[model samples]
Target: MKAALWYGKKDIRVEEIEEPKVIKGNVKIKVKWCGICGSDLHEYLGGPIFIPVGQPHPLTGNVAPVVLGHEFSGEVVEIGEGVTNIKVGDRVTVEPIVACGKCPACKEGKYNLCSLLGFHGLCGSGGGFAEYTVFAEDYVHKIPDSMSYEQAALIEPIAVAIHSIRMANFNTGDTAIVLGSGPIGLATIKCLKAAGASLVIVLQRKSIRQEYAKRAGADHVLDPNEVNIAEEVKKLTGGLGVNTAFETTGAKIGFDIGIDSLKYGGTMVITSIWEGEMNFNPNVLVFSEKKIVGTLAYRHEFPATIAQMSDGRIKSDGYITKKIALDDIVEEGFGTLTGPEKKKHVKILVTPDKSLLSD
Candidate 1:
């Protein structure tokens, strides 16, 4: 089997690797489609962020050179001993989260915040960037026949958007703003509209993503480079500011704008995985009685996200911009996504089987 493995910063190789075997209570999957995620890009650019290097991950006991694709969907090729309820040929998507059940957060049903939090693809346990991978049966969710493999692959990110919205608890008819027009930002825009937000604003710099933000149902798209974002948002909300704001861009400027574009009691949700620390004035929160909350990945939101996708609340037509073979992952997949032409793409899926690649 051929898998894309992370060696170190700027070093990802797609080479032949041993196929993962089925363990008791686990299921083997033949990967159909795997999307290159922002987190994966971070690892390739400035990491060891989540990829354990010197020592093994506490949960999966794997280290550097780990297989690296978490956003994936596949067909169940084989089922392991003691694995029930999931059958061979079932189309499914892996949740990919690695959490210790004994952790207080896990016991409280907030497994995304587990003290030993990790991801199957990032921490260890061979990931979905290959022809075949295995994971415990409990972590895989069956997708309806109506959903395509590409849409199934999107469930992970859509789940992320849905979870962030759920955390905000934004009321119907409330106004909201989403900072950044990346994949997660686009998903957040769609979810916000679907959840009955009366007004949804998007902040983006790239022309391609600005168009995507509109297509994703944003009521307004503002380019920070063109106007004062916080003031513009305030003007749109009748000078009261938005009821809620989501910061999906890890940039410090986006973070500051999101906080500043809030009502006296508004909530700002931080959804980006930042690479560095941020500096902001505490008086902003202290004076306004505002709240700033940070969210990790999804927590038990996959099923609802799939249902939303099936009902057309979230469209998958334009989200996927390109597809490539496993061998071309580094140059075509990662390079195209992070390079100068990055704005031209939204999501790029890679297949381990060359036969699956097409024009």
Candidate 2:
């Protein structure tokens, strides 16, 4: 089996390794497609953020040089002992979250907030950027037969967008402004419209990303570099600002723009896993009586997300911008996604099976 491993910052290598086997309470999957995620890019560019270097992850007990992908889907090739619900040949995608059940958050059904929070790919148990990977049965979800392998691979990120919308206080007629138009940002735009948000405004500067934002259902797209974001948002919202705002850029300026673009008493959801500190005025939230909330990974939103995509409420057709074989993952996949031409792509899916590679 060939797998991509994260050794350190900007150090992901594709090497041949022993194929993973099914174990009690888990299943082995013949991976079909896996998407390179923003978090993965963060680890590759400026990491050790979640890739545990100094010591083993408290839950998985795995450290650096771990297998590096989670946004993926595949066919169940083998089922482990004690696993009954999942059968061989079923199409599925793993939730990828590794949470400690003993935590207070988990006890209350909020596993994403568990004290010992970890991820399958980042913290390791082996990941999907390989020909075969094993997953705990409890974390895998079956997909409808109508969904394609490429779309199934995106369930994890789409789940993120759905979960964020479910966490907010917006309703059918409400409006929102999303800062940034990265993968997660674009996913958020589609989810917002599907959830019935009256206006879906996006702030993005890159020409490629702006086009994606529109395709993702954004009603209006603006570039902060060319205009005043807050002012333009106010004008669009009749000077009251939007009912809610989502900051997915993970940049300090995104925080500023998100907070400034909300109406008094409006809510703002921070969905990005930032790598650094951000400076902002506390008085802004105090004077307006507005609130800020944070969302981690998905909770009980996977089923709904799958349904939305299966029925066409949430679109995934144009999200995948490129695909490459495992052999070219570094140069054609991650390298292209993280280099100067980064904005040219929306999502890149890698296939470990060479037979599926396109010429």
Candidate 3:
């Protein structure tokens, strides 16, 4: 089977490797479509964020140069012993999180906060970038027949957005501002609208992304470069800021926009996986009586998100901007996503089955 593995910073190789076989309590999926996530770009540019290097990941027990995709969906080809709910020929999408079932967080039904949290694809245990990969049956979810393979691949990201919104103290009819308009940021907009947010304002500088932000259900897309983000947000809210702010940019400026543009006592949800340390003053939160909530991966959000997408409560369309074969992953997938033309894309889906590319 051909798989794309991350060697190090800016190095992703597409090479032939032994196909993964289903193990006990696992299911093997034939790759259909896998979205190249922003986290994958982070590892490719400034690595080891979630990818293990010096020491093995506590969960998967594997190190760097492992398979490198997770936001994916596929068809089940085989199921290992003891896997009951899932069977062969089922269309499924993986939650992609690996947690110790006995951990405190897991026992408390907050496994996304597991002490030694790791991801299946990023940490090890094979990945969706290959033609075939095996994952525990628990994380493999069946998708409804109404969902296409491309949309099924987007469930992971949409689930992330739903989780973040569910974590915030945001209420229906409350206004919110989202900093950054990447795939995750755009997904946040859709989730916020679906959650009944009254007004959705976006702060994005990229022209194309600004357009995409509006398409994602943002009521007003403002360029931070032209006008002050905090000022404009206040104007829109009649001297008060948005009730909630979503920080999805992971940049220092995004942090500032997320906090400064929120109404007093508002809640800001940090959803981005940052690359480096950020400087902050505790006084900002103290003076305004505002609070911040941090959300990680989705926990039990897959099924609900799938149902929402299936029933049209949450629209999932037009996010896929590019598709490429595994052989062209390095240049067409990673490079293009991070290169000069990066802003032209919203989500890029990769497939190990080259035949699908021709389709």
Candidate 3 all-Cα RMSD: 0.9
For the record, the alpha-carbon RMSD of candidate 1 to the native fold, in angstroms, is 1.0
Give candidate 2's total backbone clashes. Answer: 0
Off by over 4 Å in 3: none
Per-model tally of clashing residue pairs = 0, 0, 0
lDDT of 3 by residue, 1-359 (tens): 89999889998898898888779999999989999998999999998798999899998888988999999999999999999999999999999988898888899999888888888779988898999999999889999998999999999999999999989967899999998999999999999999999999998995799889988999999887798989999999999999999999999998998899989999999999898899999899999998999999899999999999999988888799999998999999888998999998999999978788777
Model 3's alpha-carbon lDDT is: 0.92
lDDT of 2 by residue, 1-359 (tens): 89999999888899988999789999999999999999999898889887888898999888888999999999999999999899999999999988888989999999999999988888978888989999889889999999999999999999998888878867998999999898999999989988899998999995888988888899999998899989999999999999989989999888889999999999999999888887778899999998899998899888898999999999897899888998888899889987888998988999988787654
TM-score of each: 0.98, 0.98, 0.98
lDDT of each structure? 0.91, 0.90, 0.92
| Worst ten in a row by lDDT for model 3 | 350-359
Q: For candidate 1, give the lDDT of residue 164.
A: 93
Task: Report the C-alpha lDDT of model 1 over 1-359, residue by residue, as the tens digit.
Answer: 99999999999998898888999999999999999998998898889899999998999888899999999999999999999989999999999998888989999999999998899779978898999999988889999999989889998988999999989987889999999989899889988888899999998995888898888899889988899999999899899999999999999988889988999999999999888887888999999999999888999998888888998977777899998888899999999988998997889998887777752
- What residue runs in model 2 are displaced by over 4 Å at the alpha carbon? none
Query: The CA-based lDDT of model 2 is what?
Result: 0.90
